[model samples]
Target: MAMVFADPEMLDRLAKSLDSKAGAIPQLKSRASALDAGDHVSGLPAIASWLGDTAKDLRRRANILRSPSESPFDSLAAFGLPPGVAGDPDAGKKFQTELKAILEAQKNGTPQQRAQAVKDYFATLSPAQQAALAATDPLLVGNLDGVPVNVRYAANRITIQTEYTKEAAYLATLKPTDGAYKRTQERVDTLRSFLNPRIKSYEDPKTGQDMKIEVSRQFLVFDPHFGSTADAKSSPFPDGRIAEVVGDLENADNVAFRVPGITNRLDNFNGFTNGGYQLAADPNGNERPDSAVVSWLGYDTPELGDSVDPAKAFAGGAALNAFRQGISVNLKPNAGLDIFAHSYGTLVTSKALQAGLTNVDNVTFMGSPGLGPNINSVADFKMPNTKFFAMRAPGDWVSYTQGHGKDPADFKDITRLGTDGASGHSQYYDPSTGSLANMRRIFYGGDAKPLTFTHTSLDDEQIGAAEAREMVGFLHSKVPPEIVVKMGGDLDAAVQAHFAGRTGVKDLLLEVHSVLGKYNMLDRVPPDEMFGKINDLAGNVAYKQTYKAVKDKGAPDFVAAAAGKAAELASEKLLGAVTWPVVKLLEVDRIANDAKQFGEIIDRGTAEIGGHVRELGTELGREGAQIYNDTKELSEGLFKDGGKVVLELGDTVIRPWNAGQNAADIWKIGDDAKDKIFAKVPDIAGGLNDVKNTVVDKGGDIARSAAETGGKALDKGIDIGKGVVKFFGG
Candidate 1:
């Protein structure tokens, strides 16, 4: 049967004509009443009464034409179809015809208009009617934006099952050698995978235990075509666009759309969906089980070469914006919406934002090359209340390319998070990483303090210090408590005095070099060898000055005096071989050897620390210079404030250094590096304990300070440009 719709414009015109005719009835009735009074005609009164009744009927008919029935069935009732038409055999066909007509009328309308039309049309259908329509024309209702999500889920499931059966049957009829058989089989398998719920396993970050989560699969947009010529050749993908939700989107408190980038296809849908599962998982650390994640492969992602083009991103952005609109309307009240975009997907998201995508609470870009060439600032995006966040893990060189625009990490409006446990471009969603943890915090609407990028030097210094402490603790375990009590006291004091003397030597040498450099006395030094030469000259000067100072104060060298005492003891033992001096001489020799080994260990540890510090300084210096060059016109104050933060955090290194030293001091009594007694030394342990407490307290202070400083800078509207002053420590 052909579909037909009543022309709303024609009805409107007819209503107006009837209303105009009805308006002249009152004048006609008045003229008739006057004529009856003058002529004394009894029948004129009846005529006037008849004219008035006719006018009321005309007005009633016009009202009906002006306001059509909200329900399609009601509209059909005026055409002689009863409300009980559901019992009639032809009613389903009639209803479908009318619904199709309504849909056709809205075909040329805007997306929102069409959506509203679909929403209103569905509101008139009974549950049984809806189910029947979904069963008969699954494709029509499945991809419609304004259809209820639950209904769409049902319709899409039927579509999936139908496509799977068709492909599977077609494949079985073809021989293995047939060119189409493999692709058909692959499609069948892909469709079949979505038929059942999937169980995913992830590690709970807080408890460090493996946990399992099961998620229902709902395909909002599923196209089984693999872009074979037999299918639609004009389709963008070799495999069709897909969007799979990992949980109940309608009921979820939080919904995150995961947009992937580059080389994504139906073949990788399951892998992409795994990221959705990770987002949906609610570990005990931050329990938010009422969450859903959508793996939205709604566009043909570009391959590596095609990634440089913005055409795909722009097109994908339009589709994503429409899809998000559908989601926004169907979502439960007060449910938060967020976008987790990666790589080129960040570009896609930026385009969507430019296209007026709204209602997003947060947007996170991980390892993004750029937003786009056109996106110069956060103001370019239409989202007003949305919080923007970005992260680039160490060695994620893709983000540094800045191929699209400014790196998001360098965008002042974007809050940069740490990626400490993640690496490269793909590990942002890894459960063990701080990147994922911060993502969860944002998704769950928790308090997420921005984590600073870990400076390489600080990380290296901590690692070295930890290793040194562990070695010291092991040496302490090998030492006999009795031996340490008998001879360790004097050795400990000598070691402390030696460390104190060496501490000022390095500082004094550095000070002398700085003075020379300031006065241009080192101008003739070759740039390549300047540092080595300066260290040599400065060290010699420092040594002479220190010798003079020591002589003036008559200070004794504790380590040398200890060695001299040992020699005297050995000489006395040689004269009294049968006496206690023999045993004493052995103890003295052993103590000297242990002390020498301790000094060597400290030297190696400090040297490693110094190397790391130098590397860190060089890297930071380059970064600071780059920042200065980038933001010289924006704000010098930002660069200065950032430098202050770095210097303040640099003070944290002393805590670990002190811990290492205390561990060494009490553990220096072993006869050899390996053979030693395990005993707890209270004084050294107490000192180490103090350092540990201080480190924790200082770390908290740094976090608070960074947060405060960052907040203040943002509040002051600092135009950071490409020079981002990241808050470090937390």
Candidate 2:
């Protein structure tokens, strides 16, 4: 039947508009029957409903052409209908007309009545008619709550295929500036992303022509304009995927309805579907009759930058009914129902609950900011016998933002599922997480005990700190003490190797950090704690370059010579705020002033060695390295105050020649080749020899002892990066 314009003014305008084009068709205007009765052309119903408002309004402005319902119009501007559907005007009208009867029947009905009326109408459709409708306006039929679950699934898939065809064609014609072009492109890209991964397995890349992978989950809802309704006005075009179910919703014994959070779209639809599918398959093999997990993107999620309005959920809040009704349609008498709400999805779910959910037994919320103002208690939801469950991963960062309201988990009544550090806001569905285990248990009307993972309430903590602590606890829990011990031993070996000239210690820092990053520990650990542990465990100063022998005739001269050589180099900066005295004492320019300060400390060390019958530099030994190395306090005095190791013993190596009063008696400081000549002080020659021997045994061992340890440190340092990359994926 032709639609009657309700406004008298609109009716008059339409009549004149049709009359203006009267000259083109001679016989139709003179028909004795009413316009609605005789308007059918070429076996099609009247084209008035098919002629969209856009073209109809255009006719009022000027001359416009109308086409027969059965004939394709070549000149009409693009409309929402597919080109095939638009051209073949009778294409989906039969289905549309049948559905319209229900819509008309429920027009003045209450919300509940309207919903029931739609469902009843669907119950009366024949299988052939249902199939036709699924092929025609599948988006409408599939998402409508009253439709049977299997029918909804079929309709949605058809809708997706059709939309994919239309959008693919539209993409080829879009210009850079076309309205919603980016959105259209994104829609296409998202669909491709989902479809591309469905190839389960392929021949090995090296052996086969191409590698293959599998599409693991079934996508149930892929509408781009789900939350958008045009009751009074138009909505944005090319909005994204409203939902995707990983399994068949119509035939399963258990159903999980998942709600997504902010900034999700069709592009992100598949990325998020794994959680739902994984939950179904995780602890329990898909052995049970569980139907499928529904990833409900049924609402418009605000961008992160948008203000956190509790009412923001109202946009797609009605989807909760869709969720409730879907399960009602196809679920068996004994089937179970579970709803999982995540992030901003909690807000939408909360609103749905407030309106009263039916046929739902368990409603679980994870990573919820809040429940919104209206729902203070589970009773506020008014879901009589329905139980509420909330689970926040011990380390999920989303817990810090309470935009929705107070968390459901906090209430004694709402069961909070426990999760470990491995599951962040996005990882709730990963099989590796405890949360997934709990979700699976709850879905089957069973009990799940949550891990007592530590968590900082959002109240006295910043998001970073809360995550950091969770990380510390989570990582500590995941890595067994034995592993840490083994790692610690490896790090110690690395330090030894670095000092022995096998590898650099600097690489150790980067490698360990990379490992933590691979573990996703970087987001959870505090910078200080992370760096501190890395420094303490893996970081060590390689004294290979710092320790050196000073050759001199006697112990006193060897000590002075070592100190003099130390004074010959410029100041060197080490890790943190540390600087060795060799860096300060070795400056050739500052040697004169530097020596006086270093000389006093040298006297103290030499005095200590002098009393102990230390050696002269017979064979430049580690004793000589330690002899001057011991003058840390004096060396520190020479370095600037800001140095971290002002007086720390990160001694540098420099050789000094003692050009005493007798040039013949001079000794080359660092060279073991330098012949010691303390003939002028032969009285202590025996003592000098003894000291030299002691120094040779001790100091030499410290300086260039074994490179074996350094080789290990070096190998470990290099392996750290490789190990972590491999751990995450190389």
Q: Which predicted model would earn the best lDDT? A: 1
Taking the tens digit of each residue's C-alpha lDDT, what string does model 1 give over 1-730?
A: 0001233345456656655655665666677677775444445556656655665665564454333222333322322323344334453565567668988998887667777778788889876566556655667777787777666666676676666666666667877665454555655556556654344555676896776554335777776553222222111125667887766677899899999987677755676666676666654333245788888998877654346667779999998888887656677879999999999999999989888788799999998878986776676785679988888776565675555666687676768788778887888887767887788778877645554553342123222222233333333354443332323332332332333243355564554444433322212222223333333333333444444455456667764444444544554344344434333443343334334434544555455545555554555565455544444523344444445545444544656655555444434422222221112133334445554555555555545555654554453233221112211101
Worst 10-residue stretch by lDDT in candidate 2?
70-79
- Model 2 misplaced regions, further than 4 Å: 1-92, 110-124, 173-186, 193-222, 226-237, 284-287, 382-384, 447-730
Each model's lDDT comes to 0.59, 0.52
The C-alpha RMSD in Å for every predicted model, in order, reads 38.6, 32.4
TM-score for each candidate, following the candidate numbering = 0.46, 0.46
Best by TM-score: 1
Give per-candidate clash totals.
6, 35
- Which residue pairs of candidate 1 clash? 477-677, 478-676, 478-677, 479-676, 479-677, 480-677
- Residue-level lDDT of model 2, residues 267-368, one tens digit each, is 446566656657656342332334567777776675543425444587556767655654464456577778888888888887776665666788888887
How much is the lDDT of residue 116 in candidate 1? Answer: 72
